[model samples]
Target: MTSAAPHQSILDKPFVLDLFAGPGGLDVAGHSLDIPSLGIEWDRSACLTRYAAGLDTLHADVSAVRRDAFESLPPEINVLAGGPPCQTYSVAGKGAGRKALEEVKAYIERLMAGDSDETIDRDLKKLSDPRTAMVLEPLRYAIQATRSHNRQKRPYDVIVLEQVPAVEALWHHYAKVLETTGLPDGTKYEVVVDVLDTETYGVPQTRSRAVLIARRQGLGQPFLPEPTHLAYEAKDWNRRAERATSGVHQPTLDAEASAPEAAGPPKTDGVVLKPWKSMGEVLAAPVGTHPGRRTPFLVRSNYGSSGIPGRRGVRTDQQPAATVTGRISRFVVFEHLDERVVREGARFSMNEAGMLQSFPPDYPWSGTAQAQQVGNAVPPVFGAHLLSAALGLPTPDPEDLRKPWQPATVEHRAKLRSHGCGAGDACTARCPRPEDQAPARSSAVPRKKASVR
Candidate 1:
């Protein structure tokens, strides 16, 4: 579906309504671009963090809200942006079973079919099952918004949605529904769907998400954001230079090309995207005796535990970090003095983790729930790229792609002093016992005292 292309200026200042706005990442990105936005989130801790950051927020369950309640919004709320909770749909989640997945699909089909509320409610049988049916909330709102325009009359210009790659098909279905359903004015949305790599957009973490961009009637075809960074797998500097100067537009080269085998042989000439930002660049301490130089370290999550060695735990300073999660504080790293490694380990402080997510340093974290907030947040840098793409605005300069690197200030350090400890306890590490000591002496290593002090 397509429409008359709207000018970039109409997109420049669209009022954005961010659903599932976890910690206001999308809003931060929107505000940075001077696009007015408000975040709606249910997590109190995340809401607190949003408040701390001064983001406009609605602290309510999105599923419970009604469209009429939002009628007071600015007449030009052109962009409806959000990433619904993906726990139920995420492959990493154990609850992602065939039945639940099918139910979500059925939910979308029914909603788009204009089933009565009672009929839809009856079909939602596993209401008690936490993971059941949350994925359809965006469709619910989209339908409600459409209904409102049909009645009270308010129309949105753009809709942007994202989720884990697992939910790509679901989004495709939603897009089809939106594209086919003309508004009372006999207009339809132009929908585009793609899975985007967060790393390709300069977020330090290599997270991938399914994205749906839809522009309301009279706007051009929705488009995915171009990557701003080179894939981490693009190791040939000479090739990078060649591509940088070629000015070629290569869509598949962004994420798919990151995998040499899957993407086939590398193209000597490709997109001009810059190299993926390394976790080290964001988390490593400068090494030297000088004023701005500090030692760096490695963090290992669940270091001493015995298990299947799950997907990833230990993160070295030089690589981009594994995805940040609520438990990101569990990933431990070594502290260094000068060039020597300190065996004692400490995980990323909330400030560092937030920085990795492209949140501002000293973002005024609240409560002890730092990791939870950081982990759930959409990386603001990636969010900014999404916003730019949705708004038809130019992407920010590469230099502006990430939070500026700066050493922690004394006050910042003080604020994060208690952040690295794991849930309900101080920091800990596993150290080898003396070789000759009895089994009794070989107990778990005493928890390491936090090194921040």
Candidate 2:
């Protein structure tokens, strides 16, 4: 975790409301920055999860929530944030039924108006022009309702919505809604379809999401945070940095070399760093071992699992583990030992999996099964970076939270050899029938600690 700098002041921090706040990742980001927030989620488990994180949670469905509820909240809310259910729009679920699409439209409308159950149901049944027609219903209702109330305050000073890239189509309708609601043109709202990886901000996983930030007329366009750590590169193999005690080197390149190549070198004249975190780093220990009793799985099939591992599995000391999913899979890939007790498998723990997605270690999740809850959450770290940018705050640097790895000491190597492999060349040799002796250990290692300032 990065040390908290003395920021401008508490009063300057914005208040936030997180809609469709599954497991509270968005709320977690708000709270971490001392931004008071209210989270609304319909799922009982999700509500409990947010509550566990010390957030004010409303268990009512966003579609059913009345406009008065929003009006009841403090008028100081500067940011309205949420990652509405994406399952209906995700490419994986490609066939986004009209019903599902309408639901999304309704939710947006409600967000705009405050919901009026009587009018919503009647209009939704007859609504056409699926795109605008669906969303405009709630928006129109809300506008009229707010106008009728003659409330002195606007619903929210800023609105942030996150979803898959496909959400751009909905923006046109949302923009129209803004116009109808008296928001002036050139209102300084931005819809970013391409997003940088969250891992670039220090969370171990690489997750790309689309973010939209809309502010009331006066605020400027939200600033996107700059990349902090460069992607790991082969050229950086020899680079070293100074540290408080001994020097530390960056982790050797793993499977991340296959990361989608960038168009060109970054403008920042330093070695490019990888944007995705390795499963090895994220999965520090075996599954079901952490205090939360979460378990990690190997994705063998799309949506099934072989159950969690027990014993007798390959070690993952060198190879990158399987892609972590938000759902269970056919295979079980936890840290386990083979018949020879060789711990050589590519797997991760649930905690590490969440970290890869940039969620804080303590973010709460509640569900009947561990996989269901963890898989359904957004990484809070990613949300924080996104929200920080939306609020025009400087983005947090990924290196600021990265835990530098210490090279294996001589004793550690000896321990590895004792486990089974040969002595001299066994420990350092790369896979694929090792030929040459491992490279000599460097006395002058690069320093790993650098601040963002």
Candidate 3:
């Protein structure tokens, strides 16, 4: 697939705009590939963390921003990636899918009609649902950008969006909207949407997200990412963890017995993929502090004395972790010490949660907000694979994993101070840098580029 337009070489690299950017998860993935990335976040704490990481950020609510605001961007935006706030669509949340879809459509129509703020605010307040319609904001930007710029000079080349699985239907609706509605030149978009599991991308967590990739007509066909890691199975785990985690009846192994029969693997992308990374292998330390042979924890949300139906708790060290949610504080961890297991209370720290999400260990995290951000973030490792697919770059080297955890660098802190921001002002309004022009893609990436099948 090749570009349909002619002209500048500046658009060679993707210029990423991560809306609803949380703690720079997607941006970090983009940065690792040497792609110039900018984030738009409304949360003060998230913006603080982004700035501390030396990332370019704009602390503004995405719903309030106008499409014209992006006109100042340097390189033509090749990729517009975002994971809108997903509370309303998440299973852990209200699961208000039908209502959310309707509201979003209505909101978009109102916006297109140039509805007054007072009228919009009245309607929004009456619904009392701030997050449901938030998903439409990105589509609004996409529609406007494509309309303003002709096909030969499109504003954006690719659109990448992610959300909880429950939003898949909405995404399908969105794809229809983009496909049926042609641009000013009667050009339609090529769209693909599917749900992807994080573990399949080698992340240590079993988080699944709905992904959408849309290419403006003539930018080649839209492609979906394929799994780079092995699917999780009971037999493909460390012995101790396997015995502790697997729910299927596992045959006891004699010390001298031959290995169990291995299942034939499925082929994808014409490559033999590596096994999924387990929580035990990633942590290296025992998980689940409660007394038992288990070393990993099966955490759930809002499971208290209420006796929820889907509240079966299990333990293991062999498999990937359950989806990391905002209520990570409620996850209990047990420790195995000596010959006995002890109640370690909440076993995971913010850093641990971030690590499970494939964030660098030394990634600077701040306070309670850090936990929420980490839990909601798209794992950077998974992000790397998707962004690489978008850029037609080869998959990232498995050896190039998350960086070791460490405190913020003096240079990072100094840059924060230069903007008059400090540790104390992590939740305050601070200065914002002007429009960022990303540098050329670094040569660190592998030279072998491949397209998705």
Window of ten residues with lowest summed lDDT in model 3: 444-453
Per-residue lDDT of candidate 1, residues 1-453 (tens digit):
212244264454578888878777787787667778877766655655665566666655566554335554445666788887655554444554545676776777667667876777676764655445567776666666756643355456788887777778778877777788544344478889987778778888767778888878677666777766655542342244236447432111233233223254333234455557766666544322112213545455543322323422443454466566666777766654221344675556677777777776556676546777787777788888777777688775534534433334544333332231111122212111234211111101111111100
Q: Can you write out model 2's per-residue Cα lDDT over 141-175, one digit (the tens) per residue?
A: 22433443334534455666665444445644565
Models, CA RMSD each: 12.7, 17.6, 9.3
TM-score of each: 0.72, 0.60, 0.74
Candidate 2: 10-residue stretch with minimal lDDT: 444-453
The Cα error of candidate 3 at residue 312, in Å, is: 5.0
Evaluated at residue 436, the lDDT of candidate 3 is 30
In angstroms, give how far residue 389 of model 3 lies from its true place.
1.8
Decoy 3 TM-score against native: 0.74
Order of models, best lDDT first = 3, 1, 2
Q: For candidate 3, lDDT tens digit of each residue in 223-302?
A: 66667776554323334333543643222222222122346655565665666776556666433321222343433333
Winning model by lDDT: 3
